[model samples]
Target: MRKSAALALAACVAVPAFARTDVGVSIGINEPGAYGRIDIGNFQPEVVYAQPVIIERSRYYENRTPVYLYVPVEQQQHWRRYCHVYRACGEPVYFVQEQWVEQRWREEHPGWRRHHRGWDRWDHDRGEHRGYGY
Candidate 1:
Protein backbone atom coordinates (compact mmCIF):
# COMPACT_ATOMS: atom_id res chain seq x y z
CA MET A 1 0.00 0.00 0.00
CA ARG A 2 2.74 2.46 0.96
CA LYS A 3 4.74 1.66 -2.17
CA SER A 4 1.72 2.33 -4.37
CA ALA A 5 0.96 5.57 -2.58
CA ALA A 6 4.49 6.91 -3.08
CA LEU A 7 4.46 5.84 -6.70
CA ALA A 8 1.09 7.47 -7.14
CA LEU A 9 2.42 10.71 -5.70
CA ALA A 10 5.40 10.61 -8.03
CA ALA A 11 3.17 9.99 -11.01
CA CYS A 12 0.90 12.84 -9.96
CA VAL A 13 3.97 15.07 -9.96
CA ALA A 14 5.23 13.54 -13.19
CA VAL A 15 8.57 12.99 -11.52
CA PRO A 16 11.17 10.62 -12.89
CA ALA A 17 10.68 7.09 -11.58
CA PHE A 18 12.46 6.27 -8.37
CA ALA A 19 12.43 3.65 -5.65
CA ARG A 20 10.86 4.73 -2.37
CA THR A 21 7.97 3.96 -0.04
CA ASP A 22 5.94 5.94 2.49
CA VAL A 23 5.12 9.66 2.39
CA GLY A 24 4.41 12.63 4.70
CA VAL A 25 4.30 16.44 5.06
CA SER A 26 5.53 19.14 7.47
CA ILE A 27 5.86 22.93 7.83
CA GLY A 28 7.54 25.67 9.94
CA ILE A 29 6.50 29.20 10.89
CA ASN A 30 9.08 31.89 11.56
CA GLU A 31 9.24 35.64 12.10
CA PRO A 32 9.89 37.86 9.08
CA GLY A 33 7.89 35.15 7.45
CA ALA A 34 8.25 34.51 3.75
CA TYR A 35 6.42 31.74 1.92
CA GLY A 36 5.75 30.42 -1.61
CA ARG A 37 4.47 27.24 -3.21
CA ILE A 38 5.15 25.45 -6.48
CA ASP A 39 2.84 23.09 -8.31
CA ILE A 40 3.62 19.48 -9.10
CA GLY A 41 1.87 18.51 -12.34
CA ASN A 42 -1.33 20.16 -11.18
CA PHE A 43 -1.42 17.87 -8.18
CA GLN A 44 -1.76 19.14 -4.62
CA PRO A 45 0.87 21.81 -3.93
CA GLU A 46 3.07 20.98 -0.96
CA VAL A 47 5.72 22.95 0.89
CA VAL A 48 9.11 21.23 0.74
CA TYR A 49 11.27 23.58 2.82
CA ALA A 50 11.60 26.99 4.49
CA GLN A 51 14.09 29.22 6.28
CA PRO A 52 14.63 28.90 10.03
CA VAL A 53 14.17 32.29 11.64
CA ILE A 54 14.17 33.22 15.31
CA ILE A 55 14.49 36.45 17.31
CA GLU A 56 16.35 36.76 20.60
CA ARG A 57 18.79 39.00 22.38
CA SER A 58 21.81 38.31 24.60
CA ARG A 59 24.68 40.29 26.13
CA TYR A 60 27.31 38.01 24.59
CA TYR A 61 27.26 37.72 20.80
CA GLU A 62 26.91 40.92 18.81
CA ASN A 63 23.20 41.57 18.54
CA ARG A 64 23.98 43.46 15.38
CA THR A 65 24.47 40.27 13.40
CA PRO A 66 21.25 38.88 12.07
CA VAL A 67 20.36 35.28 12.83
CA TYR A 68 19.66 33.07 9.87
CA LEU A 69 18.68 29.42 9.49
CA TYR A 70 17.06 27.14 6.94
CA VAL A 71 13.71 25.43 7.41
CA PRO A 72 12.31 22.44 5.55
CA VAL A 73 8.73 22.12 4.29
CA GLU A 74 7.66 18.71 3.12
CA GLN A 75 4.67 16.65 2.09
CA GLN A 76 4.09 13.01 1.01
CA GLN A 77 7.78 12.32 1.68
CA HIS A 78 8.57 14.57 -1.29
CA TRP A 79 9.17 18.24 -2.00
CA ARG A 80 6.81 20.25 -4.25
CA ARG A 81 7.59 23.95 -4.00
CA TYR A 82 9.22 26.66 -1.87
CA CYS A 83 8.94 30.36 -1.13
CA HIS A 84 11.36 32.72 -2.79
CA VAL A 85 12.85 35.57 -0.76
CA TYR A 86 9.93 37.98 -0.89
CA ARG A 87 11.19 41.12 -2.57
CA ALA A 88 9.77 44.13 -4.38
CA CYS A 89 12.18 44.53 -7.25
CA GLY A 90 14.67 47.18 -6.06
CA GLU A 91 13.21 47.04 -2.56
CA PRO A 92 14.84 45.11 0.26
CA VAL A 93 13.80 41.48 0.78
CA TYR A 94 11.04 40.26 3.11
CA PHE A 95 8.89 37.24 3.98
CA VAL A 96 5.22 36.29 4.11
CA GLN A 97 2.89 38.66 6.04
CA GLU A 98 5.84 41.05 6.08
CA GLN A 99 7.17 44.28 4.56
CA TRP A 100 9.30 46.56 6.71
CA VAL A 101 12.62 44.72 6.86
CA GLU A 102 14.60 47.86 7.67
CA GLN A 103 12.29 48.64 10.57
CA ARG A 104 12.76 45.15 11.94
CA TRP A 105 16.52 45.57 11.73
CA ARG A 106 16.39 48.83 13.69
CA GLU A 107 14.20 47.35 16.37
CA GLU A 108 16.17 44.14 16.66
CA HIS A 109 19.64 45.50 16.11
CA PRO A 110 19.32 48.83 17.82
CA GLY A 111 22.21 51.27 18.38
CA TRP A 112 23.94 49.98 15.31
CA ARG A 113 25.09 52.39 12.61
CA ARG A 114 25.30 49.93 9.73
CA HIS A 115 24.56 46.25 9.97
CA HIS A 116 24.50 43.61 7.28
CA ARG A 117 21.83 40.96 7.57
CA GLY A 118 20.17 39.02 4.79
CA TRP A 119 19.77 35.58 3.21
CA ASP A 120 18.10 33.52 0.48
CA ARG A 121 16.33 30.13 0.57
CA TRP A 122 16.45 27.48 -2.13
CA ASP A 123 14.21 24.45 -2.58
CA HIS A 124 14.40 21.13 -4.34
CA ASP A 125 10.94 20.34 -2.99
CA ARG A 126 11.43 16.83 -4.24
CA GLY A 127 10.67 13.68 -2.27
CA GLU A 128 11.05 15.00 1.27
CA HIS A 129 14.20 16.97 0.63
CA ARG A 130 15.83 18.66 3.62
CA GLY A 131 15.99 22.06 1.95
CA TYR A 132 16.58 25.37 3.75
CA GLY A 133 18.11 28.86 3.39
CA TYR A 134 19.05 31.86 5.55
Candidate 2:
Protein backbone atom coordinates (compact mmCIF):
# COMPACT_ATOMS: atom_id res chain seq x y z
CA MET A 1 0.00 0.00 0.00
CA ARG A 2 2.80 2.50 0.88
CA LYS A 3 4.72 1.74 -2.31
CA SER A 4 1.63 2.23 -4.49
CA ALA A 5 0.76 5.56 -2.82
CA ALA A 6 4.32 6.90 -3.18
CA LEU A 7 4.44 5.88 -6.82
CA ALA A 8 1.18 7.67 -7.54
CA LEU A 9 2.40 10.85 -5.83
CA ALA A 10 5.64 10.83 -7.80
CA ALA A 11 3.80 10.47 -11.09
CA CYS A 12 1.48 13.36 -10.24
CA VAL A 13 4.46 15.70 -9.94
CA ALA A 14 6.71 14.22 -12.64
CA VAL A 15 4.13 13.80 -15.39
CA PRO A 16 3.24 17.49 -15.55
CA ALA A 17 6.90 18.62 -15.46
CA PHE A 18 7.66 16.83 -18.74
CA ALA A 19 4.20 17.05 -20.32
CA ARG A 20 4.49 19.92 -22.87
CA THR A 21 6.91 22.64 -21.88
CA ASP A 22 7.66 23.21 -25.58
CA VAL A 23 4.13 22.71 -26.95
CA GLY A 24 3.07 26.33 -27.64
CA VAL A 25 6.60 27.72 -28.05
CA SER A 26 7.77 26.13 -31.34
CA ILE A 27 4.90 27.51 -33.50
CA GLY A 28 5.37 31.09 -32.31
CA ILE A 29 9.13 31.08 -32.77
CA ASN A 30 8.98 29.40 -36.19
CA GLU A 31 6.40 31.83 -37.53
CA PRO A 32 7.36 35.20 -36.13
CA GLY A 33 4.49 37.74 -35.57
CA ALA A 34 1.82 35.04 -35.82
CA TYR A 35 -0.75 34.17 -33.18
CA GLY A 36 -2.59 30.83 -33.02
CA ARG A 37 -4.82 31.80 -36.01
CA ILE A 38 -4.33 35.45 -36.93
CA ASP A 39 -2.20 36.49 -39.93
CA ILE A 40 -0.66 39.90 -39.35
CA GLY A 41 -0.46 40.78 -43.04
CA ASN A 42 -4.06 39.78 -43.69
CA PHE A 43 -5.51 41.68 -40.74
CA GLN A 44 -6.49 44.64 -42.93
CA PRO A 45 -8.07 44.71 -46.38
CA GLU A 46 -5.43 44.96 -49.06
CA VAL A 47 -7.59 47.06 -51.35
CA VAL A 48 -10.44 49.19 -50.04
CA TYR A 49 -13.72 48.53 -51.77
CA ALA A 50 -15.57 51.39 -53.42
CA GLN A 51 -18.42 50.64 -51.05
CA PRO A 52 -18.39 48.13 -48.24
CA VAL A 53 -20.55 47.09 -45.35
CA ILE A 54 -17.78 47.94 -42.93
CA ILE A 55 -14.42 49.62 -43.09
CA GLU A 56 -12.25 47.36 -40.97
CA ARG A 57 -8.90 48.57 -39.77
CA SER A 58 -6.69 46.53 -37.47
CA ARG A 59 -3.27 47.22 -36.02
CA TYR A 60 -1.20 44.07 -35.76
CA TYR A 61 0.37 43.10 -32.44
CA GLU A 62 1.82 40.09 -30.66
CA ASN A 63 -1.67 39.33 -29.36
CA ARG A 64 -5.12 39.98 -30.77
CA THR A 65 -5.95 43.58 -31.52
CA PRO A 66 -9.42 45.10 -31.56
CA VAL A 67 -10.92 45.36 -35.09
CA TYR A 68 -12.42 48.73 -35.95
CA LEU A 69 -15.37 48.04 -38.22
CA TYR A 70 -18.50 49.93 -39.15
CA VAL A 71 -21.35 47.48 -39.75
CA PRO A 72 -24.93 48.66 -39.44
CA VAL A 73 -28.01 46.47 -38.89
CA GLU A 74 -28.88 46.07 -42.60
CA GLN A 75 -25.27 45.60 -43.68
CA GLN A 76 -24.60 42.73 -41.26
CA GLN A 77 -25.11 40.14 -44.00
CA HIS A 78 -22.64 41.85 -46.28
CA TRP A 79 -20.08 41.85 -43.51
CA ARG A 80 -20.63 38.14 -42.96
CA ARG A 81 -19.97 37.46 -46.64
CA TYR A 82 -16.73 39.43 -46.48
CA CYS A 83 -15.68 37.31 -43.50
CA HIS A 84 -16.49 34.08 -45.36
CA VAL A 85 -13.90 34.87 -48.02
CA TYR A 86 -11.19 34.98 -45.35
CA ARG A 87 -12.49 31.98 -43.41
CA ALA A 88 -10.54 29.48 -45.54
CA CYS A 89 -7.34 31.29 -44.60
CA GLY A 90 -7.97 30.52 -40.89
CA GLU A 91 -8.08 34.18 -39.90
CA PRO A 92 -10.15 35.09 -36.88
CA VAL A 93 -12.50 38.02 -37.34
CA TYR A 94 -13.86 40.13 -34.50
CA PHE A 95 -16.52 42.84 -34.71
CA VAL A 96 -16.51 45.77 -32.39
CA GLN A 97 -19.81 47.55 -31.81
CA GLU A 98 -20.72 51.01 -33.19
CA GLN A 99 -18.96 52.53 -30.21
CA TRP A 100 -15.66 51.60 -31.80
CA VAL A 101 -16.09 54.38 -34.37
CA GLU A 102 -16.38 56.99 -31.65
CA GLN A 103 -13.49 55.47 -29.75
CA ARG A 104 -11.32 55.60 -32.86
CA TRP A 105 -12.26 59.19 -33.47
CA ARG A 106 -11.27 60.19 -29.95
CA GLU A 107 -7.99 58.33 -30.22
CA GLU A 108 -7.11 60.14 -33.46
CA HIS A 109 -8.20 63.56 -32.29
CA PRO A 110 -6.99 64.04 -28.78
CA GLY A 111 -7.78 67.13 -26.61
CA TRP A 112 -10.39 68.54 -29.04
CA ARG A 113 -9.19 71.16 -31.51
CA ARG A 114 -12.76 72.42 -32.17
CA HIS A 115 -14.61 72.76 -35.58
CA HIS A 116 -15.96 69.21 -35.31
CA ARG A 117 -19.24 68.94 -33.47
CA GLY A 118 -20.93 66.12 -35.51
CA TRP A 119 -17.73 64.35 -36.53
CA ASP A 120 -18.10 61.47 -34.10
CA ARG A 121 -21.74 60.69 -34.80
CA TRP A 122 -21.91 58.56 -37.96
CA ASP A 123 -25.19 58.43 -39.84
CA HIS A 124 -25.75 54.68 -39.96
CA ASP A 125 -29.27 55.31 -41.27
CA ARG A 126 -27.85 55.12 -44.78
CA GLY A 127 -27.78 51.41 -45.61
CA GLU A 128 -24.75 51.72 -47.95
CA HIS A 129 -21.30 52.06 -46.46
CA ARG A 130 -19.89 55.38 -47.54
CA GLY A 131 -16.36 54.01 -47.15
CA TYR A 132 -15.82 57.44 -45.74
CA GLY A 133 -12.41 58.63 -44.78
CA TYR A 134 -11.37 57.49 -41.36
Provide the TM-score for each candidate, comma-separated.
0.16, 0.25
Which whole-number lDDT from 0 to 100 does residue 75 have in model 2? Answer: 39
Question: For all candidates, what are the clash counts?
Answer: 18, 0
**Model 1 CA deviation exceeding 4 Å by range:** 1-94, 97-99, 115-134
lDDT for residue 109 in candidate 1, whole number 0-100:
54
Of candidate 1, the 10-residue stretch with the lowest lDDT total is 86-95
Highest-TM-score candidate: 2
Q: For model 1, what is the alpha-carbon lDDT of residue 43?
A: 24
Instruction: Choose the strongest candidate by lDDT.
Output: 2
Question: How many Å off is the CA of 56 in candidate 1?
Answer: 34
Candidate 2: clashing pairs of residues:
none
lDDT tens readout by residue for model 2, 1-134: 99999999999999988886444421111121111222223233221233323234345332544332333434345655555443421223443334434443455556753355765456645556578853
